[model samples]
Target: MRLATIHADEGTQAVGVDLSQDEPRFVRLRDEDLGSRPSMIDILSEPDGLHRAESAFNAGRAAGDFVEGRLAAPVPLPGKVLCIGLNYRDHAVETGAEIPSEPVCFVKFSSCVIGPGDPIVLPRVSSKVDFEAELVVVIGKRGKHISKESAFEHVAGYTIGHDVSARDWQKGRPGGQWTLGKNPDSFAPLGPYLVTPDEVGDPHALDVTLSLNGQTMQSGSTKEFIFGIDELIAHVSQLITLEPGDVIFTGTPPGVGDARTPPVYLQGGDHVEISIDDLGTLSNPVVAEPD
Candidate 1:
């Protein structure tokens, strides 16, 4: 079942999406429905939380009080927003980086997250902002030293992620400030929906694409991943613990702006859309940081 978080009169609410229809319908889940789980993170913390959510979704669908609320990041305040770099062979080749034997991990603080339809604020401090379309893995269960074989068991679902970057700070700086370059407000745009693993078969085989102002800028597939989800989870979990509502951006494909012929960076009024097959598209507008 597809799940989402949306702004309601009461506050942010966890919802289930009915995609069976042409236009998706949203069903607001009651607190009791999710066993008093107040947020998406709380729901996923329970082993059978998704199952309970699924049942709630089905019941709500039948009753038909479908909501029309503004969307919010599926997990608005993820405990951790881990990301992988150069995890795609083609992206690695494009950047002229050596294929690493293990996953190259990084962190994007939760403050960077914005939901679909939100604006990606082009910070005044950086002029070389670039886009990276990625497939995000939403962790369901908490575990450390997770095995690749059992990695899928800990996965709640998947979503699309836009890993916006500031090239000057990321690479042009004295010591390469990746964290500073990447953690700008609204730099991490996630969601439209958080689709369950059962609904998104073969996460490593989806088509990943990004378009800037209606022009396709990045196009590739998860099949090009150097370190797949299982490998990434197992690799990261060896040290840091993986918890519910923590998300891992599995990395972007080839055709990043930094590797382009002339380097196309984001500008004010530009629209960005990142689409991953089965996970749906995440679209955000580009805006300048206010004066």
Candidate 2:
């Protein structure tokens, strides 16, 4: 099942589960649960909520329960937006970086997250904004020191993510820390929908691609991940406690703009669309910061 968060009446939001026949269709969770507004985070954090919701969804949605609001980042207020760097073989190879024995991790502030169709603002301080299309993993259960053997058991599902970057701050900064370069406002655009694990078999088997202005830029597969999801979860859990609604951006494929012959940074009006098989497409338009 595909889940989404969409605008509702009077500055509110509602959880929507897709019950499409051909085109997209979403039934409001509140309409199913007696008007209680459940955020995507709320649904994920609950132990039995998703399953119960799925059962109710299968049972049926009333014709009046359908919604027509704009979608937001599925987990709009995720606890953390953790990301892995150099975890894709082709991506690492493109930058001439060595493959790591363990996952190289970083954090993108949750404040940087925006929903589908939102504008990706190129910061006024930087001219080298680049895009990294990544597959985001949404955690379903809380765990510490999670084992690789049971990591997937704690996964709620998968979604599409973009690790937008300011190349100058990322590489040429005073110190080489990645947070600042990656934490700019509107830097992380996620969603369209959150698909359950069962619906997305063998996460590593999916094809991932990114296109800039209708031209395919990055094309690869999760099979190329140097450190797979299981390893990433196990490794990160050893340090920080993983919780439901927390997300991990499992690196990007090769063909990033920064790796081009003459680096191709995003300019105002450029459109980026990243897609992963099973997961829906996430598209965002680039715009300069307001003067």
What's the TM-score of each model vs. the native?
0.98, 0.96
Candidate 2, residues 144-179, lDDT tens digits: the string is 999999999889999999999998999888887488
lDDT (Cα) of model 1:
0.92
Judging by lDDT against the true structure, name the best candidate: 1
Model 2 CA deviation exceeding 4 Å by range: 31-35, 59-64
lDDT of 1 by residue, 113-137 (tens): 9999999999999999999999999
> Which candidate number would show the highest TM-score if scored against the true structure?
1
Q: Candidate 1 versus the native: TM-score? A: 0.98
The lDDT for every candidate, in the order shown, is 0.92, 0.87
**Which ten-residue region of model 2 has the weakest summed lDDT?**
10-19
Model 1, poorest ten-residue lDDT window? 29-38
